[model samples]
Target: MLNNVAVAAVNGVTPFELGIFCEVFGIDRSAVGLPVYDFAVCAAEEGPLVVGDGHFGLTLPFGPERLEEADLICLPADRGAPTREYPQPLLAALHRAVDRGARVLSVCSGAFMLGAAGLLDGRRCTTHWMHAPALLRRYPRALVDPDVLYVDEGQIITAAGTASGIDACLHVVRQEQGAEVANTIARRMVVPPHRDGGQAQYIRRPLPRTACDTMGEVIAWMARHLAEEITVEQLAERAHMSARTFARRFLAETGTTPYQWLLRQRVLLAQELLESSDETVDAIAGRCGFGNAAALRHHFLRTLGTTPNAFRRTFRGPQAA
Candidate 1:
């Protein structure tokens, strides 16, 4: 039912983020049996607008009035969104759009605009990690999760930096339409249909060194033998330490218990098999050391908040399933 879309073009808007909205919603893809949105780019004030890159400008076809009728309102990143104040009328327009049941999405630093409008108050949201501290400092009530690619809070969605906008947009499409439509759109765009990992997995942080080199060696062995049932005592024996000592050091080094870490890695392996291979659920569960499909389902849902079948359908599409 989400057909009409509009992007709010603020001055100093990042061209790539603005272009993401146009590429995803503005194009007419009806020939491929995809839903074609009535998309438009609208500005806060009429006339020529300067882009963020400082070397170029753009002219929007419509004004804020276009946002009034849109089912989805997209706010791409603007260079000035961090410190510059938004126009009162523009903020009111965004509030009005959401008040009447329209959804709003912010890409990267565009989350700053939503925070300024007070839309992110008491809501779980995220911006680019570099700006997350600033966002939290600016809006103390906003629960800013910096480790996610995007946070979906029903009517409002906020994404991390740059390319994460595509993931957020596709999430909306999958929710409104279905995995098939979302996958088809992703195929046309030549991006992954669905990314299984969160931004935390991609964060480049140096691991803390342990007192001994035993933890790393044990971890490497665990990864290689994920299909076998692993025990803390067994791992402790392999690492030449007591079980209690191993458990304490493992938590200190990895921030999680040995059992929890092993379970999570097994679930991650199951996800890869479900997405990239034509394996049966029972077979995958066994390979991942879950013993059966029920066990896999239990762990998968606990870890990822979704079932294996749903995850597979999301990545492989309807016919591929």
Candidate 2:
């Protein structure tokens, strides 16, 4: 159902997110046998646009009218200035896209544009976790997730950060073409076909020195061992501290509990295998330590807010796997 792709950029479009969109949808990947999109960059008003990069600027010839022709519209990670108001035409076009079945997507702060259109009202959405508070403050009606890289609430999709845009865009690829194409594109881009971790896994300065020091290394081990039932007690044992101390420290270190961390990692691994490999739901669940397909679906929905098959279809496409 997806074909043409368009990126909506206003006056202050951030270069990193613009590059992310261009990397995923703007490139010509026909040589890899993927469907080529009708890619265009549009602005609220027609004129030359100065991207964040000062070296060069992009002159856009199209306006809000161009978004109507796209099957997918990508909004960059940066939006309006804090002291300024949003352009009316861009918001209007966003509404028009939804009215016509055009998928609306936002990378990081771009959620603002979609929010302004009232498209995210009552629907789960996300932006960079750092901006979650501000977004919630501004758009109280929007359900924002601060832990994941992205949230796909069926029609409108929103991603969590500057690089999180890559995850969101790869998702668009998976939805349009298939898992194989998405993986191929990911390889070309030199990023994981899908990130096997979440923002919760990277809580930043919150983690204490000793615990935070080995957190990244520990995460790698945890991801590799999800198929085995590793308890908080066991994780604490491995950390060489008492269970009570470990539990408290882990919470202070990760902003989440060991149980929550394990569940998220399990689901992320399950999603990756489901997309990149030809595996059954039962097998994927078992491999990811979910015990069974039903259990996997339950956790997937509880945490990621989506069903396994639906997630696979969005990330792996309609293949037999």
Candidate 3:
């Protein structure tokens, strides 16, 4: 039912984030039996708008009026979104869209625009991890979850960072159309058909300082030996420290506990095997140190919100799965 789509562009919009919406919805992909959207990019502000980095300017044909007919409205990240004020007309359009049951999605800092419009009030949403704190401070009522790739609150979808915008858009497609249509579009785009919105964003943490690089070596060993049973006590011995000290240092360095870090790595390994190899789930579980398919399934579902077989089908197609 989501046939009409519009991207509301303001000055200083990030080109890559804006392109995410254009690629996902604006392209004509009906040749493969996919639904073609009536899409437009509307300038929320006056013409000759400058893009991020001031590299170029855009003169859009559509304006806020185009948003009136859209079933969904997209807000891409803007360089000045954190502090800049959105146009009154644009904000009014957003409120009207949601009031009429149309969805509004924001990519990265574009959530700031939604916050300005009061659309994110009392809604659980997210933005890029770097901007989550500012978004929360600016809009105190918006529940910001910084870890996930996106948050879907029915009429409002907020995606974290850059590529996660693709995930959110495809999710909307999958919801409104079907998995086959979403998967076909993903294939055409050469990206994943589905990445769970709940999946953690890839945030890099600084390594913990150590006098002799012992903890670094231990973590390297842990990654290398993920297929084997690992214990904090054993890792502590290898690092020449007590179990408690090792656990504390691991948490400080990785921002996660040892068991959780291992579980996440094992799930990642299982995903790689599922996509690249023909190994049975039991075999993969053993290879990843899960010991059995049941354990693998439990942890995989907890971490990725999808089963191994389903993930394989998503990446390798149904016959491959």
Candidate 4:
């Protein structure tokens, strides 16, 4: 259903963020059976638009009128987004798109455009952590959560920083088309197919005191053994540190506690199994260390806002159920 896509470009648009939309939606991937969108770069302003830092200028073929036909509108970050005022016509087009059920996505400071349009009012959204305070100050009604990689408020998806834009875009593809299509595109892009929207935007940690002082091996081991029962004390023993010290170091390195990390990894593993295999919920529950289908359902609902069967059906289709 999301066949027509348009990227909205204004003055001082960041090339990298714009490229993220182009790379995700503008490419011709029909050769591999993926949906090829009717895509264009639409100029929101009349004159030649300058890219960030004045590296280059773009004379976009499509104008604001092109946005009216799009099923999805992408707003990429601009250098002056936090303070600059968006054109009224451009903001009105955004309002029309949302009012008519089309989705709008903003990458980094692009959220400012949505805020300026009043679309972010009363909606939970996010921007790059650096600009989160400004976004909140400028738009007090918007619930600006600065920590997560992205926030998906159904019609509006806001991604934090640069690379998380890829995550948010892929998330839309996976939701609209299915996991197989999303994963294939990710393989073509040489990037991970999914990073949960709830993931920390950035880890709070100082430079490593020593090259060898890290939780890399422990984290990798945890990932590989998601089916096994994992405990903080056990992980501490493996890391060769006291339980209290290990907990502190793990939080520093991972931006979450050991239990939360393991729980999230288990959920991710369960999602993969549900999508790629015809495994029963009970079977996957055991494989992902949930022990039983009821336990899996509880955790799935808590973490993903859906039950195991419902998630499987979403990705694998109703026939899967």
- Name the best candidate (by TM-score): 3
TM-score, candidate 4, is 0.64
Native-structure RMSD, model 4: 10.1
1-321 per-residue lDDT for model 2 (tens digits): 777888888766889999888888888889878767789988765557767654556788778788989899998965453224677888888888888888988988888877777888999998887788888888899998887889998779999888889998899889877899999999999988886545653443222233467456666667678899888777777778888998887788778888888887787787678777778899999999999999998887777656777767666556743
TM-score of each: 0.66, 0.64, 0.69, 0.64
Q: State the lDDT of candidate 4 residue by residue for 256-287, as single tens digits.
A: 88888878778777878888899899999999
- lDDT for residue 195 in candidate 4, whole number 0-100: 55
Candidate 1 lDDT by residue in tens digits, 1-321: 799999998889899999899988999999999999999999875558889867898887899888899999999999986788887777898899899999999999999989999999999999888889899999899999987789999899999998899999999999999999999999999998777645543344332345667598888888889999889999999989999999998998888899988887888788788888998999999999999999999888766656788777777886545
Candidate 1 segments whose C-alpha is farther than 4 A from its true place = 206-321
TM-score comparison, 1 vs 3, better candidate? 3
Model number with the top lDDT: 3
Clashes of 3: 0
User: How well does candidate 2 score on lDDT at residue 203?
Assistant: 43
Off by over 4 Å in 2: 53-56, 79-83, 205-321
What residue pairs clash in candidate 1, if any at all? Answer: none
| Model 2 poorest 10 in a row by lDDT | 201-210
Q: Could you tell me how far off, in angstroms, the CA of residue 8 lies in candidate 1 after the best superposition?
A: 0.3
